[model samples]
Target: MIYAQILAGGKGTRMGNVPMPKQFLALADKPILIHTIEKFCLEPRFDAILVVCPADWLSHTQDLITKYVTDSRVKVVAGGSERNATLMKGIRYLQETFGRHADDVVVTHDAVRPFVTQRIISENIDAVLQHPAVDTVVPAIDTIVQGEADAISAIPVRSSMYQGQTPQSFNVKALVDAYATLTDEQKASLSDSCKICLLAGQPVTMVRGENLNFKITTPYDLRVASALIEKRA
Candidate 1:
């Protein structure tokens, strides 16, 4: 069975002191997370869709699901301490609830990114059939500068760089096995889940993502998203 793990455990630190988490903020008529969940709800490939949020917002998220989504496949879950831990929590839930299998897939996405396209989702589903892991990315348009404390460390080649997006799908058993191999130090430092597969000698396939499929992390992003949503309508 396939699962959709929508991570909504953020505290909105980057959105300049918002009243609520950015995921709960309005995007037109509905919450940002509801729009994100709606995208996956229409996908017939998924057996379960888990909306993982902070423990404090569990019932609130469930209420949002009840009010906004009409499907039974979607359910709200509480997330762990950090991003990766939250992801693992969702994976563990799937394992314990659905029974784990080597071939089962979990498509993990950010709650803020409501514009993930059907094509990107379909490609990830297709690619994960062959590859143990798959990640969504769009080629970087600007020159990437790797710096440390106001000093330039390295200027990477622009053509080779890509900005990562979500729907980072993985084989359930493979991800669980890879995650187990991490040291506490290694696990603490990780921000990307695809790197977990790599640390276990797994090859990650890449699926192209669109620029419009951006994560709404700031007020500027919210404005852009609002405009884009209006335009799309």
Candidate 2:
């Protein structure tokens, strides 16, 4: 089975007073979460699509899905305080609702990243068939620096670094097992799911992602996404 889990748990603290979370913000003619959901619906290969939203937004998210999304495969669930925990919610839901399978693949994405393409989704689904985990990335065009609050510590080789993006697909059982190995402290520090796999000593294969597939976090990113949408329109 192939599942698409949309992580919409974030509070969008960096987006200032947006009235709603970043995922609920309007991008073009639809909400960002709806835009993200459409991409998965476009593929049709996903056996189930799970939208993981904040506990407070559970009904609101379901309303959005009902209003804009016609696909019957999608369902909504309340997310946890953190991204990893939210992901586990979707995974566990999949297990409870559909039962776990060794060959099942779960493609988890950030709902605020509305620009993810059909090709990226399809590629992740395809790549996960060969490798246990697959992550979408784009090469860093600028030189990356490691820094402290007051100083630039070191510069990493540009060729060796890539910015990780999502629709990070993995074998469902493997991902669940990786999370099982984490301590509470380690779980709190997790910023990305690929890191969890790496921490568990699993290899993550990379797929080149489009530059437009950026997450809408701050006002600057919101403006950029709006401009991109207007330009596309």
Candidate 3:
């Protein structure tokens, strides 16, 4: 079974004046997270969806899901402190509630990336199935610069660098086992789920990604997302 795990536990501190978490804020006529969940729900490839939200926002997320997504396969679960924690929570919940094995595919995604298209989701699923040793990633388009503050230096590269985006698909068992081995310091410093896999000496591959899959983090991002949605509409 293919499960879509949406991580929505952020506090939205980067959004400054935005009253609520960026994922809970509305874009187009619905909440950003609702739009994200709806995308996967409409896709036939996804057998189920698990939304991970802040512990305090669990009820609110449930109410929103009830109102927007009618899919019986969707569920809401409380999230943990960090992104990895939230993702692990969703993974465990899916295992317990759905009785899915570690071999099942879990598509981990950010809730604020409302514009993730069905095509991207499908491609990720296919890539994971074919390349179990490599986690798929989309190629980066912009030039990459590396270094400290004012002395920031540009690293010249012949090959294009790919920026990582999610719905990063993984074998459920591999992911679960990876998390289980994480050291306390590693767990404390890690941010995204893919990072955990990376630190575990796992190889992440590249998959082509769309520009629309950009995550909403700031007020300006909301404005940009609004414009993109309007254009698509």
Worst 10 residues of 1 by lDDT: 93-102
Query: For each predicted model, how many residue pairs clash, with residues at least 3 apart or on different chains?
Result: 0, 0, 6
Instruction: Give the clashing pairs for model 3.
Output: 102-173, 135-205, 137-206, 137-207, 140-161, 140-162
lDDT of 2 by residue, 1-233 (tens): 99999999999999998788889988878899999999899988899999999999999999999999999999999998788889988899999999878999999999999999989999999999888899999999999999999799999999999998998999988888888998888887898998889988999999879998999999999889999989988
Query: Which parts of model 2 are misplaced by more than 4 Å?
Result: none
Per-candidate TM-score against the hidden true structure: 0.98, 0.97, 0.92
Model 3 over residues 1-233: C-alpha lDDT tens digits? 78888889999999998677889998999999999998888778777888999999889999999998899888888998888778888888888877966458888889998888888888878877665423435565666778887787777572667677787888888777777888999899875667777888776666677877888998889899999889989
lDDT for model 3: 0.82
Q: Please, what are the lDDT tens digits per residue for candidate 1 over residues 18-96?
A: 8889999999999999999999988899999999999998988999888989999988789999999999999888888
Write down the RMSD of all candidates, one decimal each: 0.9, 1.0, 1.9
Candidate 1: which pairs clash?
none
Off by over 4 Å in 3: 100-102, 133-136, 153-160
Consecutive 10-residue window with the lowest summed lDDT within model 3: 131-140
Which ranking of candidates, highest lDDT first? 2, 1, 3
Candidate 2's error at 196, in angstroms?
Answer: 0.9
